[model samples]
Target: MNIGFSAKTKAFYDLDEKAVYIQNASWSEDVKSISEVLWLNHCGQPPKGKIRGADEHGMPCWIDAPEPTEQERIAEAVNIRNAMLMTADTEIRQLKIIEEICALTSEETQRLMSWKKYLADVYRIEPGNVSSIRWPDVPV
Candidate 1:
């Protein structure tokens, strides 16, 4: 829920053209839109796809509404990394529950293992090796 607010922006890519537009502010006074900002990016021309964007010096730069600073971009990446790690932690906790179930008696194992054979028997299909069960596709 991190929200960034910005009213001041410096265009990293496009610099040449804004000077001209601002010089003629009396003639044209339309505040720059995201598309316009990109169209006026650093190389002094609009991108090929207009909205899709351009690859400037091997960087996958896009037509952001307002491009963030390097620090902000790094923070965003860190947030995503932390979220993934939290998901991994939760999965590992659930896996311990399965591990506990695996430490069962031989009779329990046989009874549980036969459940698969019971399923295939109900389907009237021959159950092969317990370690490797390939489900047949279709009504057959």
Candidate 2:
């Protein structure tokens, strides 16, 4: 499929089928079919965490996405860890209730211990280094 870009709409499209292929775009009268070779030369879509922009010649190009600051990374890490914790909340509470009411079977005891360790591991995870953080496995 041939790729095209509409400067008027600032959108990319599949020219052969006359349909927008990237970004929220509609068929525009100013759509110009970009050379497939040129598009390929520009490496098509930008890599993850990057954005599509224009080169010095105004041709489509890739640009680096802004890096998050340390504080932002820490916040993101906390958000992810909180989400993981939420998933275990109900199970942990149920196990605690069971333990309070009666003696737990060996299997239940093991499961509770595993979940507790998982929670501890998650809690001990430091922020601002989320990329290298190893997430604890979820209980089966």
Candidate 3:
């Protein structure tokens, strides 16, 4: 199931005070954006210090954590991209479903079905337009 918006408030660390706090939360359909922000907040190890605290600027600091490796950055990028692709896929699927159900003529239905089949076979991406997807025999 898709991650829908949550109405509850969210808690976060106050980097400057080194304290936990809560804020009013809002809904978002942008999964990538949410994930990226969350990664920024939680991915890294704590900065070098016995006590957790914010930087001079009162922003949360990650001074002690090691730099992110190339693989980590690449994985994060891929995850973000997938989230966006999933959102687009949902939209496309909805459109195709509506088109399929509302088609007034056999020709139109056939055309839509052909397009759906092409997407399924070639892209390994069905957009939920059909019952199943057929992956290519040869990998790209």
Candidate 4:
């Protein structure tokens, strides 16, 4: 697709595709115009904690996303940990049900033990340190 930027609208467009490639959420396909488009360089993925934006010159650029506050980070970590714990709980319950129906093989026993250990690890995780967590592998 031929990418172009509109200085008037401060938005990017797919000139050949006749669509808004990126920019304001309010912009519509009907608002696009090939004549008003300024060609832009090929853009790749934005850097970590950054997003795609236009510079003062209306060129494609990377801009920083709003940084999460410490409280927000902690809350996010807690949510992640809770979700992980819930998944582990479901897995364990399913395995236990299978165990009740028939004797589990050694591999199944190891998986059950691994899930238990993973649950423990989830409980031990500190919300502040969740970004660096080394998650255990899920048993096959």
Candidate 5:
């Protein structure tokens, strides 16, 4: 979430009146943008009081939380991307169900199976063509 749109960020800045209003937000899809904004926000917040942390070398620790490493962040992004795809897939499945609903029949189950086959033939996974989805993967 962009700092502008972050609920947590608003709370963070609200704690200090002197904190500058930074940015409005970031797209959920843009991992780098989110990470950069987060890093700048945390590391740049001038360390509060000179209090030693539990770590032996600690003069001050900005967070009990460690910075999210680049790979860890990318992994999170990967999960987000995967979930988005699954969400899209779920919507497509629902649309297929709706189409089947419109053709309500005594043989509702059979008609649904038939419509699913038709959908497989038409829906392209990569979106070059809606009518290009292969038949084998479509539900029966």
Candidate 6:
């Protein structure tokens, strides 16, 4: 038996039996108390919700389900981007008001100022697409 590790999971393979065992890090830590077995074989197909990837023995490993559809993915990205923009705008406004009474570091005051550009770069959208809720000073 050979053992291998990944960021979130660990794997054990028995080449002679053509089988592999995998467990998440949290589950593996308390494996002695678990009654269920996590086993997979080289020749068997990936079960219902899983997809396949290379295992420790260079054989197949059943992995979690794939990502959502393109439309769902785009919608999720837009939602997250909107939330981030809102939060950034709020912070920028608060920082601007606080700066009027006392000196503030440019880092703190400008942290969210370029958020639109960043989101544009990350999402491959034009910067103009990230319209602010009410932050007229922070142009797209």
lDDT of residue 78 for candidate 6 = 72
For each candidate in turn, the TM-score is 0.29, 0.51, 0.30, 0.56, 0.30, 0.34
Cα lDDT for residue 8, candidate 4? 48
Give the worst 10-residue stretch by lDDT in candidate 6. Answer: 27-36
- Tens-digit lDDT track of model 2 for 1-140: 67776655546767766543324445777666788886776655668887766655556766787788878888988998998787677678899999999989999999988888888888888876777899889987
The lDDT of model 2 is 0.75
Q: Which ten residues in a row have the lowest lDDT in candidate 2?
A: 17-26
In model 3, the worst 10-residue window by lDDT is 1-10
List, residue by residue over 42-96, the lDDT tens digit for candidate 5.
Answer: 4345455432222233112344445567667556555544554554466557666
Per-residue lDDT of candidate 4, residues 23-127 (tens digit)? 435443433342322333324556788866666765655678788888888898889889999989998998999999998999999999989999998888888
In angstroms, what RMSD does candidate 6 have relative to the true structure?
Answer: 12.2
Deviating ranges (above 4 Å) for candidate 4: 1-48, 52-54, 57-60, 129-140
Encode model 6's per-residue lDDT on 2-54: one tens digit a residue.
22323233333333333323332232321121111434352356688886554
Candidate 3, which segments miss by more than 4 Å at Cα? 1-66, 103-140
Q: Taking the candidates one at a time, how many backbone clashes does each contain? A: 3, 0, 2, 0, 6, 0
Which candidate number has the best lDDT? 2
Which segments of candidate 6 are over 4 A away from where they belong? 1-66, 106-140
**Which is the better candidate, 2 or 6, if ranked by lDDT?**
2
lDDT on C-alpha atoms for all candidate structures:
0.41, 0.75, 0.42, 0.70, 0.41, 0.48
Candidate 2's displacement at residue 71, Å, is 2.1
Q: List runs of model 2 lying over 4 Å from the truth.
A: 1-46, 94-104, 126-137
Among the numbered candidates, top TM-score falls to: 4
Off by over 4 Å in 5: 1-64, 103-140
lDDT order of candidates, top first: 2, 4, 6, 3, 5, 1
Name the regions of candidate 1 deviating beyond 4 angstroms.
1-64, 103-140
